[model samples]
Target: MTATGLTPSTQGAPDPASQAAARPTAHHPARAPGRLARSVRRNLTAHGFLIGAVVCFALFSWYPMVREFLLAFQKTERGRTTWVGLDNLTTVVNDPAFWQAWRNTLLFTALALVLGFAVPFVTALVINEFRHGQGYLRLLVYLPVMLPPVASVLLFKYLYDPGYGLLNELLRLLHLPEQQWLQDPDLAMLSVVVAATWMNMGGATLIYLAALQGIPGELYEAAELDGAGLLRKIWHVTIPQTRLILTLMLLMQVIATMQVFVEPFLLTGGAGPEGSTTTVVHLIYQYAFSFNNYGAAAALGLLLLVLLAGFSAAYVRLSRTEEA
Candidate 1:
């Protein structure tokens, strides 16, 4: 539009058509920051706790994991870090002791799970059926868990004493040949497994007991009406109802058993009887501290981590499937 609000030809004499052709002047009020400022403040306050938590997680958990990975790929000598590619992992993989430790750990895990898992469930079922002294039985089962691992392992060490150990003495009294519990390599893992099973059964027992109580009484009543035997009722009703919990506990037990450290560390004093009781965590300790090879230790730790993650993923999938 021209100054006179008309085109050049109609400038002098205003053309009604040209004036009508001019575009409308558009107005937009400038925005105030009040609403935006309030929104920013609300977001800042709401996420303040979350931001702090994330920072702490990064500073501690994430940083340590990443550092361990870096250390796994690099070797350190006299305060100097040198990139060694997969040398650390290769050394760990090539070590002859690795296979033995793996075997021992797996054996311990299988035995522990078999004994530990079933003991609690059976105990829970029996005790749940009982009419009296339930509290005392639960207390007895949990009592060992309250004892310090060192104390408990040490106590078992006394009991496993070949010469005067109560266990051997009992066997001797029963007209049975005495067997070395902790001394013999053939029995050392078994001995530790028994002790670990005893010490750890409490937690699983408590969880299963709680789950058992949560089971609906109607199921049992219906099974009774159907003339189902005790075993059949357990197989059909109890097992299915508690299957999720049993599966979860099984996976958790696997993870915890894989990281068997304190028990063997104290019981066998770092891998028992020619490393027959050596576990993966114990080996990692020996590598990182005893041999002072942080790289190999870190590499082995990363391997253990991968194994745990795989187990956990499978557990999650199985759990979700059970839910579905």
Candidate 2:
């Protein structure tokens, strides 16, 4: 033995741990180039998809918005485009139909809130209360939404016909007055609202029903134990539980109702009797297509965009504040 008490063979041998530490790992250096290439390929693929989406948005959405903004400031005359500054805005504001359209639009929104908003929620509540045939009920409610919008609107048109319409027939059977449904100036807007509600309420009803189903049964049980009736339970338990969804739906409904076009356009020919059902969107359509005033149309659209954006911002802020 040597002075250190080690055999000669052991003294020459290196420790396994030290040899391992000195050795190059299988995953390092040799595999690094392959790993780097794979990483680069993956990153490139992701970037390619992102770029395609950006290009699409730029082409379809952002481009149109920018074009509209530019068009709103410029006027075209005899195929010559000239920057008119706020002249387009002035023209839009000065149009006689401007105030009337705004009024009608506001009226439609209010009426829609009352009917379109309430009807769906009520329908959802009724459907939810039923333990059987819920699926069939939901299907029935959503059937209108599934039909083509034009078909649905045309169906309403036939129903609202002053003569020989099923509704008027039913009224006659009941010995009630057979009134002009769409022809009457006073009833024209209401008729359009009813048509819109029926056409659109299906989706909202389904959403509300889903929200209702998500509410814990224990909460309803608690409400019952507190001697709450149907309305009371809905007010205290249902509304609170689904407040967020309800608010969201309300905002969407308001935005949609404000921009109503197809129903009134198809049903009442855009401007109903005595211009009673003329909406902001209808006015925009008139400016763009009927009058061939692109600048005016863009200006009006810009105003609508601004109004909706401001309203959405306020709603979001208010909701956040309430949550806080």
Residues 1-324 of candidate 1: C-alpha lDDT, one tens digit per residue: 566656355438866777777866678876669988998999998899889999999999999999999999999999999999999999999999899889988998898888978988998898898789999999998999999888898899989999989999999899999988777899988888889989888989989999998989999999999999999999999999998889889988999999999888888786788888999899999999899999999999999999899989987987788679
Candidate number with greatest TM-score: 2
Error of 1 at 122 (Å): 1.2
| Residue 13 CA displacement from its true place in model 1, Å | 51
TM-score of each: 0.82, 0.89
RMSD of each: 8.7, 3.5
lDDT for each residue of candidate 2 in 1-324, tens digit (9 for 90 to 100): 566666355866899999999998787446678898999999999999999999999999999999999999999999999999999999999999999999999999999999999999999999999989999999999999999999998899889998978899999999999989898999999999999999999999999999999999999999999999989999999999999999999999999999999999999999999999999999999999999999999999999999999999999999999999
Once fitted onto the true fold, the runs of candidate 1 whose alpha carbons sit more than 4 angstroms away are: 1-60, 321-324
Error of 2 at 230 (Å): 1.1
